[model samples]
Target: MSAEIILKANHISKNFGLTHALKDISIQIERGEIIGLIGENGSGKSTFSSIISGVYPATSGTLELKGQPYKPSDTMDAQRCGISMVAQEMGTLPGIGVADNIFLGREEKFTKYGIVNRKEMYQEAAKAMEVVGVAGINPADPISRYSLEERKLIEVVRALYSEPEIFIVDETTTALSQKGRDIIYKILRRLQEQDKSVLFISHDLEELMTVCSKLIILRDGVFIEELEQKDFEEERIKELMVGRKLTGDYYRSDYDGNFGEEVVLKAENVHIKQVLEGVSLELHKGEILGIGGLTDCGMHELGRVLFGIEKPVYGEAVLGNGEVIHSPKQAIKNKIGYVSKNRDQEALILSASIMDNMVLPSLSKISSAGLIFKGAEKKFTARQVDGLSIKCREITQDVKDLSGGNKQKVVFGKWLANESEIFILDCPTRGIDIGVKAFMYQLMYQLKKENKSIIMISEELPELIGMSDRIMILRKGRVQKIFERSPKLSESVIIKEMV
Candidate 1:
């Protein structure tokens, strides 16, 4: 690893409207270093990286690359200056081939007489895929043909193809499985070995500790502290990020497996063609039944099937009152709720207001015989916004403008407002900070106490082990094993069945 400084930010700051997204921040990335950026959502990690990589110009201050003033007008400009960023959100364009998505914005390289050469693009894409250790994706297939995780891998390949001197991974790992994560970790290590710099942003502290040589902490868009690898401690990092000591058990303490005798929801040999095969499970009242699996292990699909978003070809999802879940409207009418793994796409209306999203699902309850009461809707939305402690300028603030954690809280708020009895949550805590995650755990326990059945589908093993009464491990679209949660239950025991 070289000690040569590759990128430097001198007192950079950013503002959107009247909101200061980043304060007077200054930082550096040396060659061959993997620096971890940690903070709660909207704490300026992405803003700082964006300014450095030229997604947009900073409001104030300057940046230097290898001792030269670096002011890129756009992402392509940054790319020309040897900087590439894998965004936290899905960056792949739909309807285009995988190769096309990988080489997007650089199609001129493949141009021959004003036409792209398909053969050469495929060859280059395959090489990039091989270098990134990504396989099972055909470059000829449309980008939309792949899952989010697969799309994220394609984005990884795209960023790696440039082989930039400064590579910024902005919260991309949360979308990946263990295999995908390992591939990225390997790439980060290889970058370090080649004396290139990597700016890694992740909500997973354990992953940061494993891969980062140094860690930088940010709070409310201000630089807080920097720690060497030896100073890495999960609790201390959480404290600094939150700016307060979190004093409590992180997960639920009670491990009693005693749940309601009645099954609130049951999947009787539910099948989703190629995705899910003969998956059967029972969710009892007042229980958090966790589903743990690999990314493609059909756990996400199970949530869809149960919530009537996707119809099962073979079997049925029966509710407590013997009502079958045939469509999402039917599921909603029957008091069943679902929080999708894809929060932006499936759960919340990003362009809509917080009040709009919170009141959307409860319109049926808040409406009169022939008209909707606007004041009642506001009251209802405000109650949930306050209850969830969602950080926003106002209830009318756009959901898209809020942080990832606050957006997730809005998802929960909408469901909680609807007062759903059975909840199917897929990756509920994905890409959230430790403080929000702890609050979510406590909320789940509160729901469990209220006798609301929850079916949690997650790729995270620790969360499943920590909060579940019983965990179902899925492998290849089938239930491989089921473990009853106890004081003795550990991640190793659940992981044994997951793999």
Candidate 2:
């Protein structure tokens, strides 16, 4: 017997002002199947998913849910019709309790005579979180108390609470660590076992291959091709998505791990409460120092402490010039830059224009006698935008409107324009596509050649091996080992130290 079709999207097209976000596209989701959506940034992967989830109405198209005409006015309407989505961006709201975020719009169920039953809602919310294997999150606590990864899992709980037949995950896994990813994987498998459907959107091709049974490819808002599990090939999928064969090295070609003897940035016996304990490291000029560990292994905290975002309880991070770093403002003034792992919240001002964000770090350089120059600002912003190939209508466009890759470019461009000598990049390439990842790696290589220093903190072991001159493995608020860069450095060796 043939499998039942759960949802059908026909001749879908979407537009925003003069820009065509998605062209004519048609796809279907089948019961008991996992479908992967693959494409580069701004390729309409999220747009299509948004149309189905009722976040945006299609400019033209028709949708059939279980062979019935489905027109959802909003996300809640879609949820009522057994459709749910976990957005790529942060979806939970601050200044609210975890239980309130879980049952955002559907709080009517817990309403008794116009008074919300807080006790009953918290119980249900706790149960929902438990179902997703997320522990230690109190439903009564404010959502702001949790980290980005935990909040992502909370969004998962919210989506799963609806028990929708069609579950859409839009680049949500990129923000999660291995433990969090395993929880999502388990949820997807359980949904498949129950004869439900999933639409998995991701930039990680290897991850898609592992979790999805079939893959749909899109390029420049057009449907290019689709592939089954048996026909899946990395190069072929990349070609189909980008419309060209990717050439050149994906990472640094040389195995030589030589770096300057001069220490540019040093963390001297730094400690951050429970996060980092006696973490000491040296970032030399013209070096890419990769720090790797599990999600809560304290490497990220080390990065923040080094960048002066978090103060160490005991030791300090100092520069070769004997400048003591005490705050972010002082660090920036001393030619140090930081790219946060939580890009949206910490790196870029989403509401501001690209020009504003790009010129923020260089405002003093472009200003004279307490006066700002629009000409200088435009010139600076224009140079970075063109050099980085940041796709946008204009520099005046809002940063939030750009794709994830372009947003990251803006973050990089700001620091580059400021001429920062030392960079602390945390998860720099997260949620971006392969093409962009390659570009970022090349950029780092160029920075190294210019004698700039870098401290790259990441959760991915392969990236740590691929880019760093030396790899430092942290486990439970302590450095387990530091391995020099060599051709024979394998993930297995690094994993041993990290665990």
Candidate 3:
């Protein structure tokens, strides 16, 4: 608590048009401390982070760095002042090698007379990779060759190579697996030991409580409270973040009733290449069935197969009333919704408006007798926007400009409008705030109440334990064990089965 204050934000405020994004917020970041910036979706956290990281200039405020007034004009300016940020959406250049991406703009260090010094670049890249706990990635290899988790590591490495004194991490852990997160923690601990400052942002309260010494709460562009480590509680933090006390567990399901006589979805001996070997599963009405294992354990392949995204060599999925779907188009026509693990790639149409995206799934429904009903479409879109609590000035606004949580809600809304009987959600709440996560869980419970069966595929053990009425653990594409909810599953037990 006696640590030196490295950065101070005094009465910071910003506005977009007539809307206030930040309303007179003040906070101090101390050296060697891990501080968490907590808030709901669109609750000024991103705006505040952007202000500090030089993505935007504060309308009225003063930012002091080590007791000296600092105003950064751009990201490069912020970096020059010893401040750097690594945002959640991994922004590594796909076509370039790791070394090239690391020293992207500042290639002069690895250049001589306009010629790149490839040898020096590789050495620096290797050192940066090691510092960030990524050693297996080859400096010469293109970034496109890496996975999402691997690209996440590259972003961290890029920042480390820039030599930042105050590191701003914005929800970086949501993309990472538990093991990948552990590696990040190690790097943060090392930075803390060296008396460097870190502002950690994440939706996982448990992880934040374990790491952050101080927590700042935000609500609707207003600074609500700042709590010490002693005051940290899961319910308390969540309530503060959303300005309300949430009911039920982190995941909600009513386990008292049967799964129903009607089969909403049936995967009959589905196989995709050699990864899936005659895998079959049945999901009934009003059920939340979870599937989990390692990333490469064939769990993902199963979702793709069921959704008709993957071309199966053998077997098929049958909808309610015995309608077979051989492709995604057929599945869509059958009224089945799928949310992929890769939100950026598979789920969202980034360039389209939130309204356009939301109404996409139900275009046919809105079209009447070969005539498009625009008014009816707007009515449907409005209902979805309000139901999901999607934050945007208008449905006409591009989804690309919205926060990570809002983008996900748009994807959900797009599917929900179609009146889909079955839902397949793969890591639906990844890379978002806790308040948004709670909302996602609440939405799922609401859907369950409507007799909509869901298949949740996730790599997170706690999420599976929290939400699923029934859980299936797969190992090497084989169903190892299935656990029912009444038994009250534990993380350790599930993890043991997974390994």
Highest lDDT: give the candidate number. Answer: 2
Q: How close is candidate 3 to the true structure, as a TM-score?
A: 0.93
Computed on alpha carbons, the lDDT of every model, listed in order, comes to 0.90, 0.93, 0.85
lDDT of 3 by residue, 144-249 (tens): 9998888888888887777788998888888887778888899888889989989998877788999988899989889999999999988888889878887666
Off by over 4 Å in 2: none
Clashing pairs in 1: none
Q: What is the TM-score of each candidate against the true structure?
A: 0.96, 0.98, 0.93
* Cα lDDT of model 2 by residue, 207-307, tens digit: 99999999999998999998989999999999998899999888999889989999998999988888888989889999999998889999888888887
Stretches off by above 4 angstroms in model 1 are none
The deviation in Å at residue 367 for candidate 3 is 3.5
Q: Evaluated with TM-score, which candidate comes out highest?
A: 2
The order of the candidates by TM-score, greatest first, is: 2, 1, 3
lDDT score, candidate 2, position 409: 97
Please say which candidate is ahead in TM-score: 1 or 3.
Answer: 1
Off by over 4 Å in 3: 247-253, 270-278, 312-325, 368-376
Where is model 3 poorest over a 10-residue stretch in terms of lDDT? 249-258
